[model samples]
Target: MAPNDFDNSIHDFDTTDDGSGPEPSPELWRHTPFTAFVAGEDTRAVYVRDHLPVLMPSFVVDFALRCTEFRSLPGHIARYAESQAWGSAEIEALRSWQRKLVRAGLFISRTELYTRAAAIRESNATPAKIGVIGFSTAGDRADLLLRALGSFAENVQTHGRAVDFLVADSAVDAGHRGRLRGLAGERAADLGVTLRYLGEQEKRLFATELIRRSQCRPEAVEFALFDPFGAGSAGGANRNALMLHEAGSVLAAVADDVLCELASTDSGDFKLALFSDTDPYDRWVFADRADALEAVSFEPRDYLAEQEKLLGRNLGDLLAGVPVNEVNVRKLGLTFLHLLDSGAARIRTTHLGHAGNPAIPTSSFYAPHKGTERELAAEAEIRYRASFASRGALARLATPSVGDGTVSPGMAIGLDHRELLPPFFPVLPAEDLVFGATMGACCPGALSGHLPLCLRHETNGDNAPLHPGEINRARQGSVFEFSQILRAIMAGHQPATQADTTARMQKLGRYICEFAAQPTLDFREALHRIVLTHESQKIMALEHALFTEIDAPEFWRRDIRDFLDHSRDRMQHEDFDIPYELKAGRTNEENRILMQKLIASYGRLLEDWPAIVAAAWDLRSEGKQFSASAKAD
Candidate 1:
């Protein structure tokens, strides 16, 4: 029968007669012995009821000899069966007995039976420590581990030997009141073994055991764990190494298993490779303490000061030391500076900080304030904007005085607004410049390189909801028109005439509106593309920025190039090098169609140069007039 066809209630299966009778009422079954066992009461009765029929005659005799009540029950059943001539004819009678056991919840499910049998065979072949780590509040996982262990221990084929298990919980608190502990302890005791809990001192204890087992020195083990910041024990790297040094192998979550394996290797020598996720090419390898310290000491103080001088602002706080909260911001600023110096046209930005905000104090960056939401946000904005201006970029603070402003020819449009924009458009302030520069350098076609400049918006203050009409108007008025001008300059063979530029802009606006109206447009897919592009771009941008800031750029460049090549090789060796697949449940054909549309749009942006320049000039003139009018008022 199908799973759905089965009766929902256990009471539907009769225990008496030929195992076929009227289904019992749910209320009646609720009070049965099996139900009582399931409710955590009188488990021994259910256990005995299930196993008694399955036990061999000699085992039953021995058990009966010990217990007075069941002394003659096994004998009586055997005699009765023999008198009736037990054979194929008595198969229905035997099935009825099994059905009764099932109704009592004594018979195991087929899956559980096979699993237990398999575990028993494995344990008999090779005895080893079976470690189970459960996260705090994950009682279900803990229960599953305990049940599997119990099944293996109770199986007769396994010689009734319990497996050694270490139950570790990752929760740092001293709350040991979980019911899994009690359940595991009881089960372990029944199976003649003890349940062990590994606490905060587990690492040290395991390490000590490992040293004893392997007869190795404490300093022989090294850990290669994920630690973005060199915070030592706080980041768990130091602690992991210490544990593995004392213990031959450490038990950790699947994510941390790779780190643990670094220590478990038979060979004592291993190199630690630390690389920035933002820049795949930027890497450091620490063979010893000296290499690590040397890598850390490469300062960008002078480089940052040069940028600060350009913007007429203090950016020492951003480059002084890494703030815990704004780790990525410094890299972002450096990337933007490098791109600007590399002859990229006006870098676009969204929500770049205003000039009014105070520079973050050196002390504040090192020791952050732990306070209410308002205080934290205030501090974060300060650091965020300081980091942006660290590279000498101007802030396009959105105010009512300037209404949806214009971009200069070969310059980025600065949309410094408080309203939230569509997910596809680059919304992050100065970070967009970094992404744009990287994208421009790495991607094919002139359009991919410059498309980023058209979408940048420099926002300030909190995000507020924007009306769909307002969003549509902003996209149509400035961004679409600006993109057309860029496309004409980059891809158009001939100089753009006034008429050609005007025609292209009009067509682009219509396309934007039509695309927005489409029901099939996936906002999530657009967001995913933005993220992927950012990641890929950031890698190149970060490497370029690092090379520009560091002393002996040529030597460092060679090293970084070699490191990236090696890293790529490693990824390939590990089967981690996979080609990008179209996401958001899109077919290959759909992806191709979308790409063609984007390419066509980019083509439209490449029109006549003169027309594009003229259009920008007109917009700037209009913006100046608006600004003058606002000032006059």
Candidate 2:
């Protein structure tokens, strides 16, 4: 209790000269514990005195994650991460490393980012190019496109001049073109927008024409068109981009199954809201209107009160009245161009959210980090049903985003000026992730809104599987429907600029090419090594985001064990055999060669991206000039 109660100097403490080394002082047992209890070693003597952290072994973090019981109330690993002064500093150090790394070269470094932003300002972009692309390949989806056009028509009818577009069709089929032309003539007045139709023959011609005009290599043009055996989606999406570019629109895109559901009610808005975990493509609501709202949000008190009422708080008075800020969200029908204008993100493209059914696999549940991993199909169905049914918008809006982390493209995201981006790979699963990664690296901004991604509806109901063992069937990960994070790892998602992304794609292309060049038995092993390193790095990025970017510790801690369990199981299983099996017509050897060629196209596209973009810009300029000259004449 007094100043003289204990000696102040190290000389007063007890120690032993064991000869091996000076023994720790007898007072060593009292070091701060980082957990509720210690099941393993909790203390260690200083080996490197220079470093300030005096925490226990590194596995303690894992121990915290795996802990079945929380002996200490109200403190999770995030809390433990904070309680240690050294840990806080260490985290800050990691955060600083990421901020520097992300800014310098994710896709483009912050320097290049600012440089491009400045150039845009200098050029004073000619009224942001925005268009809604509906590339219909199937003759049957005409009705769906018509429905979307109906929405567009209504917007124009409601707000004149706010909606205007011109569509061009160079139809190859005489009959189809004639019909389309007559239909356009009839509908143009009502729709308040231009309408175009490109049939199968026209699409093929356009593909060849685009290839020829761009001066692409013979192989690239061949690959883009024929794509023997139908091995890729690149041709179609590429066609969609070309269609939009030719028509002079570059913003939103839609598919056959997708609907552009603008509200007929007063609360109508393009509810491509932003959810922290996903992008803003959950539900479709769009109009031909452009007005700005405050960015980064400025919520009123009534917002919280309304949220509480909706969430069933104070149930006694359920019908409580509260003011709603309609203006804050009424601008939902905004184009992606407007979002970009208001500084949402400098993304090469944007992917909106979806609502029907999520785009993923049932196999995702095959290997989960949760304790209920082996739950029966009935149980899992309940959970899944509950998840899909939950519509807690109030809580979702209140939940803030993790700074700068990106969500991959939703099912129906907007794509603009496709040639400006590197080509998508032919054989790679989850290839869009690689494309998105490169795009994100180009700019380090992600718009935060209240929404979600993917909207595929369930093929089955809450009942049991129609067939025996179907629900609990052990499906392989090799299927095309699943997401292989490895694709992103290959594309160097964490850091790939236009130049850098091209180099990485080229490198991977070379690896694939080399793998197929010879009759080697180590195909799987070779691919394993390449993926292993980046997977580790991906995990590190996840940790960096969790510890530094987001504030919800309890909500995000579930991801810590994801990589850990992944490492444990993948080593025991040959999960790296990415193809899993041979293609129908080819043996392993032939398939490898086929894969190499397909992958090689991606590299070539990346290499020619700058040229492709320059050519596209020039064509757009020429078209604009031609219009101006014609007007003057």
Among these predicted structures, which one has the highest lDDT?
2
CA lDDT scores, all candidates in order: 0.26, 0.34
Candidate 2 segments whose C-alpha is farther than 4 A from its true place: 1-78, 81-129, 136-140, 156-192, 222-226, 232-240, 243-249, 262-348, 361-406, 415-419, 424-431, 441-486, 489-523, 528-593, 624-633
Q: Tens-digit lDDT track for model 2 on 1-633?
A: 112311222133332211111222211111112222343475432222123333334344343333222111112233444555446666554333322222222112112222232233212223234444443223223344445455445543554324333222322345544554455445655554555444434445544555666786656544533344445433244443343244434444444444443211112332112122123222221111010011112222221111112121111111123111111211121122222233334323444333333333332221221212122243344433333232111111221111112444423344434324444443323545555544443332323222222222222233321111222234322322212433533433323322443454444544434543444555445555655654565456546644663433332234334434453344445543444223244564565555545555554555454444454456655662111100000
Candidate 2: minimum summed lDDT over ten consecutive residues — where? 286-295
Question: How far in Å is the alpha carbon of 37 misplaced in model 2?
Answer: 32
lDDT of 2 at 462: 34
Model 1, 449-516: lDDT tens per residue? Answer: 01100111112333322211223322211111112222222222322222232343344434443433
**What's the CA RMSD of model 1 in angstroms?**
35.5
Which 10 consecutive residues of model 1 have the lowest summed lDDT? 257-266
TM-scores, one per candidate: 0.18, 0.50
